[model samples]
Target: MKKKLLVFTGSPRRDSNSAILAVEAARAARKAGASVEVINLSRLRVNPCRACDRCRDRGPGQCVQKDDMKKIYPRLQQAEAIILAHPVYWFTINAQTKLFIDRWYAFGADEYRCFKDKKVGLILTYADQDVFSSGGVNALRAYQDIFSYLGAEISGMVYATSAGPGQVKKNKTALKEAYNLGRELVS
Candidate 1:
């Protein structure tokens, strides 16, 4: 069976550097024979978790909110692999990405069983010279902890410093890394 990979783009800006890399990765994943879907979180109306603990009462992957995330839940649960591509803002993951991830709390009702053994990939684009200066490390660290807690394997990460939109196109190394990450996740 073909591996199903879900790619989430967290940039609010259109054609953002991170989104560009995500597209590149998705293209490569498809070429590698994996079934891939790329969802733009900024285009969705995903609300923040209410901390109501209602999902725990209901069951795994259940949320109280009636929003677009209702559609994402099934895809997220069924995917064999997932890729999160975003830009670091305020020294951490952007609000869009954070909000989407926070909603994953619903999966916690089942101890994140849906994530066990799942392959994960990360692509981060920042405006500084390096990860440390851009605070991209903070986001990476958070993902490390988040996926580790969920028993998901982080297959790869590609981070680049692109000061403006489309600048990441000049970063061949990062682009190559993103392509490799996609292929690796499904392989």
Candidate 2:
């Protein structure tokens, strides 16, 4: 059976640099015989987690929020790997991606058992010269910690510096790395 992979684009801007890179990654994954789905978070009406603790009582992947996340919960459970692609905002992950991650608390009932052994990939874009100056390192660290706590296996991470919209398309190396990341995760 083909590996299932989900790519979530978190940029609020359409055709953003990060989204472009994610597209390339998804293409490569599809070529590698993995089934890929790309979801644009900006277009979805995913509400912030209310921390009501209802999901704990309800069970894993069960959130009280009656929004787009309700649909995503099932997809998340089915996917073998997930890639989070986003541009740095305010020295860290943007609000859209952060909100999505926060809602993962519903899986806490099982201590994130579903994430154990699952593959994870990260793609980050920033405007500054490098990761340190752009604070991409902070976002990377956050992902590291988050996935670690969930017992997920981090397949790879691809990041780049793109100052403007769609600038990442010009970054050949990052694009290649993103493609390789996708293939590697499925392998």
Candidate 3:
């Protein structure tokens, strides 16, 4: 069966380089025979986590806040492979993306467990090689720490370094890496 890969973009810019790069990766995965879907958090009306803790009491799928997150929960639960494509913001994930990650608490109870044995990847775009502002290798590390607690394995990550607006489209090397990641997702 073709693997179901879902790419969630956290950048506020709907068509940001990171988002486009994710699309490219998904396209590559499709060509390699894997089913792919991309969700742009910036465009969706995902609400912030309410911290109601009802999910903990209810067992599974119990967020009380009625919003776009309801749509995200199911997809994340069902995806065989997931990709978090985001731009580096102050050495961390963008605001909306970070909120989504924090809201993942609804999926875990005792010790952080959800979609066991599933594969996860991080895709980041930076504006410079400063290793700080634009992001260096630490971007992947931040994602690893969170996913590790969630029981997801890091299959691979694609990074576009020293990239600016429209830079990703010209970054052939990064694009190829994205394509390779897509192929690997299904392989």
Q: Considering every candidate listed, which one attains the maximal lDDT?
A: 1
Please, what are the lDDT tens digits per residue for candidate 2 over residues 64-117?
Answer: 888999999989988999999999999999999999999999999978888888
* CA lDDT scores, all candidates in order: 0.94, 0.93, 0.78
lDDT of 2: 0.93
| Weakest ten-residue segment in model 2 by summed lDDT | 162-171
- lDDT of each residue in 94-142, candidate 3, tens digit only: 7878887877888866445456778887788877775465654676667
For model 2, the stretches where C-alpha displacement exceeds 4 angstroms are none
> Which portions of model 3 miss their true places by more than 4 Å?
110-112, 130-133
Candidate 1 RMSD computed on C-alpha atoms after optimal superposition onto the true structure: 0.7
Candidate 1's error at 101, in angstroms? 0.6
Error of 3 at 116 (Å): 1.5
- Residue 44 accuracy (lDDT) in model 1: 99
Lowest lDDT 10-residue stretch of candidate 1? 162-171
